[model samples]
Target: MKDNPLVIKLGGVLLDSRDSMKIFFDFLSTYFHNYSRNLIIVHGGGKIIDDMMKKIGMNINKINGIRVTNSSNIDIVVGALAGIANKRILSYLKRNKINFIGVSLSDGDSVLVERSKKLDFKNHTGIPKSGNPKLLFDLLSKKILPVVSSIGITKYGELMNVNADLAASALAKTLGADLILLSDVSSVLDKRGNRIDSINREKFNALINDGTIKNGMIVKVQAALDASEVLGKSVQIASWKENNEKLKLLFNGELSVGTFVYK
Candidate 1:
């Protein structure tokens, strides 16, 4: 029932399980039907993309779990991962009576971006570094679900790949929406791998840089930092492992189940 919308990044793997999704969809339908808040669901396609790569005999290389998208990988990623996933999500939303639309980063409008000079992994690895958040806000203001991929196109008509985490952060900042990141882990865990629950931005950053947080998590935590710094919004990292309260607790009131990465 709030004027500000919630920007949710739907993890690609979450769509794999039918039983789990049914529960999630039901919860989402109930939440949105009763709550008047605007929500823009952004998603990733890591799992699906990996599957396609295997089937096609494409070599999958990862520097800290991010796909090294060469020309060949990019083709399958856009078609199988982004395209197929978008349709599947939209279909599920339709069944629950939650209105939504599948939109490519370019579908809505030109998501102008500047790619690295080449596949410069030493620098940006050829992935597009910037985006146009105005496209997301325009759709959000009009009550569109606006599912987005991490792809972008430059003004000179160059298509490029971007990270979903980065894309979601940019949109949240531009629109000033509550940023919610869904993952497989139960929020930001402590050194012993236990759920840390809630903490301020200062603490989170300190832990991350201090090696208390390392590897793949660094990317997600950093994305939250961008949202908080750019838009003054709070970010939450929660897991779906515990069943019902996985996502709802952060929206509606509940108990400590995940970490709230906030400013």
Candidate 2:
């Protein structure tokens, strides 16, 4: 898919640091101006949501890294992710003079989702079932970058709290795009805490079985694996904390600084 966009997913911690965001926008500004490539950004704000809920006297309930959301707190989830976090990123893009549109997973019918029965979240949690990337494609055709939040809706118009990693995968699949999941970790680690330069399904399964990958990393890696398989390409797990030069190199295909998960 030569015409496909490049999807970059941002981890929430990067949102907390001005220097990190500055470097990110600096690299993006250059890439947008020089490369003339289409780009899409999917973001998570779990830490921001946690802080807001804590301030409002709401309990931070979660099961296996998925927030255990309910009708009572779904509003807060929406406000935190789509409202606050989304605007915060948009502010950076605007400052950089990047032509962009801010949206959520639900906007433009980009991602269709429903209640996730896999978990007992007591109410409104969702998993992406399918997608229609036409709206995103239209934006890309016009060379407008989209900054998407991990918020979705069901057929019946119910709000959903989706995992950002999974949201990015779903979008990349629908758009037939290459994905880069930028988190705080430089790469996937092994049992000895060394970086895994590359991984395949078999090795990934072995790592999971032996308990080397746990917590949030489990979900993030699984998302990358799923995207790799679907797209028939390798997916990268890199850190957003890296400096502008490393990010530029990564984007330019000049260097490999992260774990590449192959199908």
Leading candidate by lDDT: 2
lDDT by residue for model 2 over 69-179, one digit each (tens)? 898899999999999989999998899888899998988889888889875646888887448889999998888899999899888888998888778888888888778
- In model 2, the runs with Cα more than 4 Å from the true position are 1-3, 120-122, 209-211
**Which residue pairs collide, candidate 1?**
none
Residue 72, candidate 1: C-alpha displacement in angstroms? 2.2
| Clashing residue pairs in candidate 2 (N, C-alpha, C atoms within 3 angstroms) | none
Which ranges in model 1 have alpha carbons more than 4 Å from their true place? 109-112, 117-143, 198-212, 241-246, 252-257
TM-score of each: 0.81, 0.92
The sequence of per-residue lDDT tens digits that candidate 1 reaches over residues 99-213 is: 7777755554424356667456332222333245676677666766777776666555655566776666666655666677776766777888777776676887788777788
C-alpha lDDT values of all predictions? 0.67, 0.85
| Candidate 2 overall lDDT versus native | 0.85
Please give the distance, in angstroms, between residue 198's alpha carbon in candidate 2 and its true position after superposition. Answer: 1.7
How many angstroms is residue 170 displaced in model 1 relative to the true structure, after the best TM-score fit?
Answer: 1.0
